[model samples]
Target: MKSSIVLGLGFGDEGKGVVTDWLCRQAQRPLVVRFSGGHQAGHTVVDGAGRSHVFSNFGAGTLAGAATFWSSYCTFHPVGVANEHRALVDLGLAPVLYVAGLAAVTTPYDLLYNRVLEANQRHGSCGLGFGATVARHAGPHKLHVMDLFDDFVLEQKLGSVAAYYRQLGVSFAEEVLEQQLEDFYRAVDYCRTAIHCTCGRAHFKNAADHYDSLIFEGSQGLLLDQEFGYFPHVTRAHVSSRNALEMIREYGLPEPQVFYVTRAYQTRHGNGPLTLEHLAPQLHPTPYETNVHNPWQGEQRRSLLDLNQLRYALSADAQYAAGLARQLVVTCLDQLDGPWWVSDDDRRTTLDTVSELAHRLGGHWQNCYGNYGQAGNLVAG
Candidate 1:
C-alpha cells in the first residue's frame, strides 16, 4: 500500500527522473504510473555507475527494473515505443510496459501536422505530435492503443486523421505518405508484441496486489498545465496532481506521499514568460546538460530561483493535494557557485545553505531532500 507521486514544481527539467529512480530503489517492486503528458517527456536519469539515459517513451525508472503503466490520460506513440524498446534491450534491460486500452495513439500524420504547425506559429512545440494527437482525439477522428491491434479500425481512423490534417493545409507527397504509413504499421506490430494493453482503472485498482509500491510519475510541470498555464505556450495536458489524485481515489488508495521537485534555479524551454530570466546572471552550460538549443524547443533558458513563483505553484497544487503528505526536493545544488540566489519581487536574496532556503520557503514539508549530483540526501535537521 505504499505509494507516492512525483511532480515538477516549475517548468520541467526538475530532476523528476533522478528522484523517481531513487524512489524505485527503495521499493521492492515499483510500478511507475504516468498520469499526464506523453512521449514528449524527456526525463533524464544518471545511475551511480554514471550510466545515463534520457527517458521519453518509457518511465524514468526503467533502468531501475521498475515496470511502467501509461494511464488513460497519456498518449501512446508506437514508433517511439519501438525505438525506445530496442534501445533498452540493447542496454541489457528488459522493460515491462503497460498501456491503457483507451489511451490516445499518436500517428505519423500527427507528427507531420505538428511540425508544420510549429513552423508556422512557433508556439514552442516539442515536435513529437503529443498535443496534436490529443487534439485529434478531441475532434471527430480518434485512435487508441487498442485500435492499433485492429487493422480495419486503425486504417479508418488513420485515413481520417490524414484527411483532417490535409484540410488544415498540411500536405505531403503521396510516396512520402505511403512510406510513413509503412513504417508506422511496422512500428505498431513491434509495439503490439512488447506492450500489454489493459483497462487503466481496473488495473490500477488491483495494482497493489501485484506490486509492492506505486510511483506516479508526472510529466511537464505545474506551470505548463493546460488550465493554469499562460495559454498558447502551455502544454495540452494537466501537469498538476489533479489527474494523479483522481486515479488514486478511483483505485481506493491511501493518501500518497507527494514529492514536489525543482532545481536550485528556474528553467524553461521553448517560448514563455520566465521571471528573472533577463535579470539573473547567465550560467555557463554544464557539460552533462541534457537540454540544448533546438529549432523546435528553442534554447533552454535559466534564471535565479523565484521564491514567489515556487510558492504560487505550490499554492495552486494545494487544492488538489489536500491531506497528502508533501515533500520538497531541490536539485542541482552542485550547480550553485555560492549560496542560493533567489528572486522575490524587485529584490534578490541569497541563502547560505539548503537548510536556510527550506526554512525561508516557509512551508510544512514532512521532509526536504537536497540533490547535489546524481543522488539526493535528506537535509540535515
Candidate 2:
C-alpha cells in the first residue's frame, strides 16, 4: 500500500477537494488525512452523483465513505465543525469524522482578536482567527481541545490571553469575555463526545496494514506556505508534500505517488500577487462567499500562470519528490483559448495576460510547460 499527498500549487481555492475526491474513487477505502491549517480553508467536493458539498472544517472524503483525520497542526472550530456536520447530515451524508486529541481549539477570544487585528492592519487575512490562535498558542499558556473539559485550566488560559491582549491596548468587556468563554466550553463539550479523536497512530496503522492506499490532502498552496511562500502574507502552515511525507514516515508506510495540482489559468484568493487583468474575459469571477472584502474582484478576469512562478513551485516539489516521486497535474485547461503564448511580428503575447505582467515583474518565463492536457496528463513537447 502507498500513502500519497495531493496539494495545491497556488494561493488556495485550487479545487483540491475535487482532486481529492477523484483520487479517492481510484483508491480502495483510502484514509484521508489533513495535515495543516483549519476552518480557514474552503474545499468544495462534487460527488459522482453530481451533488456538491462545500466544506470548511470537514474533509473532502466525508461524502465518499473515507475516514478523515485532522492532525495536531490543524485548529478546531467546534461550532463550524458541528454546523458542517449538520449540513452533511441534511444532505444525507455521514457525520463520522475524527480529530486529533491534541488539536488546538479556536476560542471566541481568538476570533475577536483576529477581527481586531485585521481591522487595524492589512495582512489580507481571512479573519478566521487562524493567525490569532497561533499567536495565542505561542504564548505562555497553550490550550488544546483536550483542555476544554478542564474548566479551571481553560479559564486560566483564556484569562492569560485576555490579559495579554489588554496589555496590547486591545479591550474586551468582562461580560463579553465571560460569555465567549462559556460558549467555547459548551462547543468543546459537544464536540468531545462527537468527533474528537486520538487516531493518528491507529489510523496510520490501519492504512499501513489494511488499506491499499492513503491520501493526505493539503490546504493552501506552495506560494502561501509559511516557509517557502511570500513572507508575512502566507498561511501559518506547511502547505507542501513534506508534511505528508513526514506523517507517512512516522507510520512506516510505503511511498505513494505525489500529485501537484495547478490550474491552466492561475487564480488566487485574498490579497496577493496575481495576473488576473490579462486573463480572458470568459474567465470572469463568480460570486463566492468568503471573509475577503472584494471576493468578486478576481472573478472579473482569469489569472495567467507565471512560468517563472510555476517553476519556483515545481522546484520546491522536486525537492520533496526524492522518495515517492512526483508529477504535475494541470487543471482547467479549457479556460485557455490558445497556445501558452501568442507571438506577433515583433512582440510576444501570452495566452494568459497575467503571464505578461509577471514577466514585467522581473519573473522569467523559460520553464512553462510547453505541452499539457485538460485532464492533467502531460505530453512531452
Candidate 3:
C-alpha cells in the first residue's frame, strides 16, 4: 500500500514531468493520479519510445500503461483533452484517461474573462482561465461536468456568468456564446461515453490494495500556492504535498514516500522574481515562449541565481514538506553550465563551462540524482 506524491517545491515547471515519468518507468506500471490544477499545466514527459508528450489535460503515465484519474479539484478543457487523446492514439498509445464527472469544465467565457482581466493588469497568469475558472466555481454559481447533463441548470449557470461578465463590461457575441455552449455539450457527451470518471475513491482504494505503489502527481509549484505564496501574484491552486496527502487520506491509502522535484537552476515562465540580469551572462541562453497571447508578451530567459527566495518558499511550505517529503530530487543538472554563484561574476563564469561560483552557495546543494537514458546516477556530494 505504498503511495507516493511527487510535487514541485518551487514555482511551476519544476521538472515534475521527468520525475513522474521516471517513477512510472520504474514501476513499469502504476496508478497515476492528478489531483490539482487544470489544462494550464504543461507536463513534458519524454517516453521510452523517445517520443515526448506535453501533457496539459492527461497525466504523464499515459505512455507507460498507467491508468490516470483526475479528481474533482481539477478543471478540464475538453478540446485539450481530446487533442491529447488524439496525440496519444497517433503514437500507438491508449488514451484511456478518465476524469471525475464532477470536474469543472473551462469554457470559452472563462478564457475570454482570463484574457481580458490579465491583459493590461499583469497578474503573472498563464492566461488559461486557471484562476478565473477556479474563482467561478468557488462560490454559489458553481458548475461541474455533472451539471452539463442538466440542460436547464447549465443554461442558467451560463446566463448568470454571462450577466456577471456583462456587468464587468465584457460582452460576448451571440454566435460565439451559442457555439461555445454547443461545444460544451458535445464535449460532455464525448466525455460521458469515453473519458468520464467515477469511483474515484474506489480506484484509489483498489490501487492501494492491489498495487505495490500509487503515485500522485501534482501540477504547478509550491511558490505559487494560493495560501502560502506571494500574495495576489500566486496561482489559485494549492501546489503542495498537503493536497496530495489529503487525497491519499480521503482514499484510505497508506502513506508512502514523498519526493519534491526541483531543478538545479530556477526557471519561471511568466513575470516574477528572478535575479536575471546578474546571472544572464554565464548561463546558456534560451528564448522564453509565451504559452498565451496577452500584455505579458515576449519571453524572458534568465540565469539561475542563489536567491534567498528558495529558502523563503521552503519555510512557507515547511508543514507540507515536514509531513510528506523523504528526499529532494534536483533535475536538469546536465543542462546547467558555469559556476553556480551567489553574486554574478563576469570573470569565472562561461557559457559552456560548468563551475562552482562560490563555496557558500555550494553548501545549498543536497543529495539528489540525475536521469540520463536508461541509467539514473547520483550526483556526488
Candidate 4:
C-alpha cells in the first residue's frame, strides 16, 4: 500500500505532469488519483516516446499507462475529458478513468458565466468556469458527477443554474442558451459511456488494496490555494494536499510521502504576487514548453528564485500535511543559465549549490532533486 502525493510548491506549472509520469515509471503501473482543481490545469509531460501532452481533466500518469480516479474534490469537465481522451489515443495511449459520484461537474453555463465575470472583474481566470462552478454549487444550484446519468435531474439543475445566472443579470440570448444547453446534454450522454462513473469510497478502497502504489496528483499549486494564496489572484479550489490527505484517511490507505515540485526559476501563469518577478530577467523559452501567451490568462510570468517565500509555502502546507515526509524536486535546471541566485534585499547572492538552498529553506528533505534536460533522467541528491 505504498502511496505518494506530488504537489506544486509554487504557482501552477511546476512540472507536476513530468513528476507524476516519472513516479509511474518508478512503479509497476500505479493508479493516479486527482484530488483537487480541474480542467483549468495545464500539467505538461514529454514521454519517453517523445510524445507530449498537457493534461487537464485526465490524470498526468495516463501517459505512463496509469489508471485515473477522479475523487470527490476534483471539479470535472466532460468536454475537456472528451478532448483530452482523443489526444491520449492519438499519442498511442489508452486511458482508464474512474469518476467518483460526488465529484463536481462544470457546465456550459458555468463556462459562459466565468467568461462574462472575468471580462468585467479581471480576476485572471483560465476562462474554464472553475470559479463559476464552485460559486454555483455553493448556492442551491448544484451539479454532481452522478447527476450526469439522470437526464431529468441533470436538466433541472442546468435550467436552475441558467435562471440563477439570469437573476444575477447575465443576459444570454434564448437561442444561444438553448444551443449551449443542447450541447451540454449531448456531452453528458457521451461522457457517461466514455468515463467510468463509480459510486462511493469502496471502489477506491478496493483500488488501494489492488494497486502496487497510488500517486495522489494535485493540480495548480500551493501558493494559489483558495484559503492561503494572495486574495483576488487565488484559485477558487483547494490547491494543496488538504483534499488528498482526507481521501487517503477515508480510504484507510497508508500515509503518502509528499513530493513538492518547483521550477529552477519561479514561474506564474496568471496575475499574482510573485516576489520580484518583474525585477528578474526572463530566460529564453524552453523548446518543449506548451504554455504561452493566451487570451484567457494573458502572458506567462517569471521571476528569480525566492526561497524565503518558498519556505513560507512549505510551512503553510505543513499545517495540513502534518506527519508526511517532504521531498523537494527542482525542475527545469536546463533552463537555468550560469549560477543560480536568490534575492537578498535589493541585491542578489549566488546560490553555491542546491544543497545550500535546501539548507537556507531549513529542512532536510527525504529526497532532493535537480531534474534537468529530460523527464526520466533524475539528478541525484
Candidate 5:
C-alpha cells in the first residue's frame, strides 16, 4: 500500500492541510489518518474552486472526499465533531470520520478549565481543551470514545473528570456546570448519528489493506512537539513523525513517503521566542490566511526562515525517519515578494529561489516542492 505522511517542519500554519488535500486528490482512494493531537487542530484547506474550510475535528482531506481515521493517540470532542460535521455538510461535503475507541474524549469542563488556565499562563493554547483532555486522561478520571456510546458510563466518567478538575482549583457555578452538561449530552446525541467508533489498531490494519493510499495528516509542527519544542511553549502532543512512524510499524505498513512542510518564511501563533520577529512586516500576505488574532492563541507571529532551527528539527526526527523516503515542501511561496531570507547560525543568506534555499540547507532532501498561494497549488523543484 502507498503511505504518505505530511508533517510541519516549523511552528505550524505551514500549509499542511492544503498539502494533505493535494495528496488526497491525487490518490485514487485515500484514507486520512490523524496520528496525533486532537480536536484543537486548525488545519485550513481551500479547494481549487475557492471553497475554504478550517478543519478542526475532521481531517484536512475531508474536502476531497477522503475518509478520516482518528487514531488512538488523538482526542475526540463530541461537541466539536458535531459542529464541524454540520459545517462540512453546509459546504456540500459528506465527511466520513472513524474515531478510534481508545481516543481520549474532551468535555466542556475541560474546555472551560483550559480557557481559565490559559488566561493566567498564556502558553499559546488554542483554548479548545486539547491539553486539558490529554492531562485528564493521564489522571484517574478518564474518558474515551468507547465510553461515549454508553450514556451511563459516559456520565459517570464525566463526573469524575469534573471532580478531578475541581481538585486542581478549577470550579464552576452550579448552573454553569448544569448547562455545560446539557450542551455536552445534546452534542453527544448528534455525534452518535454523525461519527463511528472503530477498534483502534485492528481497524487501522484493515484500512491499510482496503485503501490504495493512506495520508497521515499531522497537527502543529516539529518545533511544537512536547519533547522537542521549547518548554512551556510546546504542545501536549507529539507533533513530530514519532507517533506516525510507530503506528506504521505496528500495522506492518511499508516505509512511508514523508513530506516535511514549511512556509517560505517562519510563522508562529501565540507567545514564543520567534527567531526573527522584526522581519514580520517584510513578508507579504496570502489570500487564504486562516489564523487571526484571538484572546486564546493571541496574535499569529511571523519571521524569516531559520535554517539552523530547520536543521535541528531534521536531526531530531532523523532517528525515527531512517529508511523513509523523505521530501521537502515549502509553502506560501507567493508571499515572498523579494529574495528568500534565511538565517543559519550566526550568519544569514539571501537566496533567489526555493532551489537555492534547499541547496544551502545541505543534501538532506533530494526533491522539494514549492507551493504558491492557497488552493493547494504545488510546483516541484
Candidate 6:
C-alpha cells in the first residue's frame, strides 16, 4: 500500500492540515486516519479554491474529499465533531467522519473538570478536556464513543463519571453539565447517520485494498507528546509515529512514509520552554492564519527557528521512526523574508536559512516542502 504518516515536529501548529489535504489529493483521496490527539487540535487546511478550515474532531483531509477515521488512540468529542460537521456543510462540504467504538469520548463533565483543574494548576491545558478525558480512562468510570448509541450504558457512564469528578473535588455549575449533556445527545443524533462506529484500524487497514493509499494524519506535534515531551506543557497523547507504526504492524500494511512538518520559524501557544524565546520573526498577518490568542491556550507566541529544539524533537521521535522514509514539510516561509539566522546570531550570512536547515536535517529527506507547496521539483538529489 502507498501509505504515509504525517506528523508535526513542533508545538502544535505545523501546517499538517494542508499537508494532509495535499497528500489525500495526491493519493487519489485516501482515507485520513487520526491516530492521536482530540478536539483540541487545530489543523488548518486551505484548499486549492482558497477555502480554508481549521479542522478539529475531523481529519484534515476532509476538504480534499477523504473520509476520516478516528482511531482507537484518539479521543472522540461528539459535540465538536457535530459542530464541525455543521460548519463544513455550511461551507458546502460533506465530510465522512467515523469513530472507533473503543475510542474514549470527551464529555461536558470532562471539559469542566479540565478547565477547573487547569485554572488551579495552570499546567497549560488546551481547555478542551482532552487531557482530563485521557486521564479518566484509567478508571472504571470511563466513557467511549459506542456508549452514545446505548441509552442505558450512556446514562450509567455519565452518572459514574460525574460521581468520580465530584469525588475528585471538581466544582462547577452542575446545571451546565446537564445542558451540555443535552447538547451532546443532540449532536450525536445529528451525526448518527453519517458517523459510523467500527473497529477502525482493522476495518480501514483491511479496506486499504480498495483505496490507492492510507494517510495517517496525526494531531498536535512531537514537542507536546505525553511521554517524551517536556513536562507541564505537553499534550495528553502520543504525538509521535508510534501509534501509526503499531497500526501498520497490526494490519500488515506496507512501510510508512514519514512526513515531518514544521514551520519555518518556531511558535508555541501557551506556556512552554523555548530556547530562542526572545528572537522575534516577522509575522505578516493573513486571514489564512489559524493560531490565535484564547483564554484556553493564552497567547500564540512566535520566535526564530530553534534548530536545537527541532533536533531534539527529531531525536525523541526517532525511536518509533526507524525504517520510515523520512521527508520534511516546512511552512510559514513568508515569515523569513527578513534577515534572521536560526543557527546563530550572525544575520549577515549569505546562506539561505531553508537550505542550511535542510543540510543540518541531512540529505536523507526524500521530499522537502516549503510553505504551502513543494519548494521546487525534485532534481535527482
* lDDT, candidate 4, 1-381, per-residue tens: 688999998888888888888888888859998988888988888787787788888888888889898887878888888878878888888788889887888988888888888777876789889998998888888889998898798878778877888789887667976787777777777788889998547676577456888999998888999987888988988878888888888878888899888887788877767888765644555786777887777898888878777887898888889678888888887776677766754467777556666776787677787777545655766
lDDT, model 3, position 241: 71
Give candidate 2 regions above 4 Å deviation.
173-183, 275-302, 334-381
lDDT of 6 by residue, 85-157 (tens): 8899988987887788999989898988888878787777889999999999988889988888888998898
User: Against the hidden reference, what TM-scores do the models get?
Assistant: 0.95, 0.82, 0.84, 0.95, 0.96, 0.93
TM-score of 3: 0.84
Q: CA lDDT of each candidate? A: 0.85, 0.67, 0.67, 0.82, 0.85, 0.80
Looking at model 6, the pairs that clash are: none
What tens digits encode model 1's per-residue C-alpha lDDT throughout 145-165?
999898898889888888888
lDDT of 1 at 244: 87
What are the per-residue Cα lDDT tens digits for candidate 5 across 53-170? 9998988999889999999899998888988999999999899999888999899888888888999999988898889999888878999898988889987998899789878887
lDDT value, residue 113 of candidate 6: 85
For residues 1-381, could you state the per-residue lDDT of candidate 3 as single tens digits?
567787786677767777776677667457777888889888877665577778788877677777788888788887667677778889888776767778877877887788777786777887878788898877655667666667788788777766666766877677977797677667766665568567577566566445665778888887788887777678888777777777877878877676666656666667666554455534443222223334553364445543355555566556765554354566555544554443333233322212232122232333345543222432423
Native-to-model Cα distance after best TM-score fit, residue 98 in candidate 2, in Å? 1.9
The true-versus-predicted C-alpha distance at residue 300 of model 6, in Å, is 0.6
Instruction: Name model 1 segments beyond 4 Å from true.
Output: 173-176, 281-285, 375-381
